[model samples]
Target: MLSGRFRLLRREEPERANAAIGLDIEVFDAWTGQARAAGTLSGGEGFCAALALALGLSETVQAHAGARRIDTLLIDEGFGSLDEEALEMAMEVLAGLEAGNRLVGVISHVAELKARIPARLEVTPGLRGSTARFVIA
Candidate 1:
């Protein structure tokens, strides 16, 4: 499940980690094919792995007997470190979820990500504290 989901979310990553052991996942370099602890992953890599795990878990829950189907998911932060290609991959996965009638809300401050997202709720620090603005398209 983890391997398939990771590939769906990160096609560029060719080699997907085996995450059956919870937080003790082992990641392999796509080119080198060398495996290492998940902790060795860079910020962007970690974020992608975490997102894949969340998505896989969501699917598992929805598929479980007598479990209610989940319709919404909210991810806060973690986009800033991802390079353009990786971010695009993540966005593609989220778009798939949206297409399936699921609501995927991403809370991020990265300008690039913000520009790509069609609708967003932005929060900015202000003199009083913070202010939020909702944007559509």
Candidate 2:
């Protein structure tokens, strides 16, 4: 699953090296096809990779938890840097989680995300104080 997701984000398979000391990951650029250290990935690319890994871990946990699969996932501001196409891809992946009866909560200020999400909890701050309202579309 991680491999497939890496391909989705990078258009190529991710290469990993297991040194005696630790693990090293190389993520290739989608356009240039040049590999770089995972730590060197841009914010969006790193988010994609981290999201893939997290989703995989969630799946594993659910599978092993028997009758107690995780029911909720909260993503906060992880969509800040994704472009349109990457946003669409990420949304598709997140939608799958909801389809499986999990509650996916995304906390983002991105306008495009607000349009796409069916439900939201909006927070507002004024000189007086702060307020929050939940809306479902």
How many clashes (backbone N, Cα, C below 3 Å) per candidate? 0, 0
lDDT for predicted candidate 1 compared with the true structure: 0.76
The most accurate candidate by lDDT is: 1
* Ten-residue region with minimum lDDT total, candidate 2: 2-11
- Encode model 1's per-residue lDDT on 8-79: one tens digit a residue: 222233344643343445666665556666777788888988888798888898789478898999999898
lDDT of 2 by residue, 18-119 (tens): 333223556655566666677786688788887886787787887888856888999988788887677888999899889998999898888888788989
Model 2: which residue pairs collide? none
Candidate 1 residue runs with Cα over 4 Å from true position? 1-22
How do the predictions measure up, each by TM-score? Answer: 0.77, 0.75
TM-score of 2: 0.75
Q: Candidate 1 — which pairs collide?
A: none
Cα error, candidate 1, residue 32 (Å): 2.3
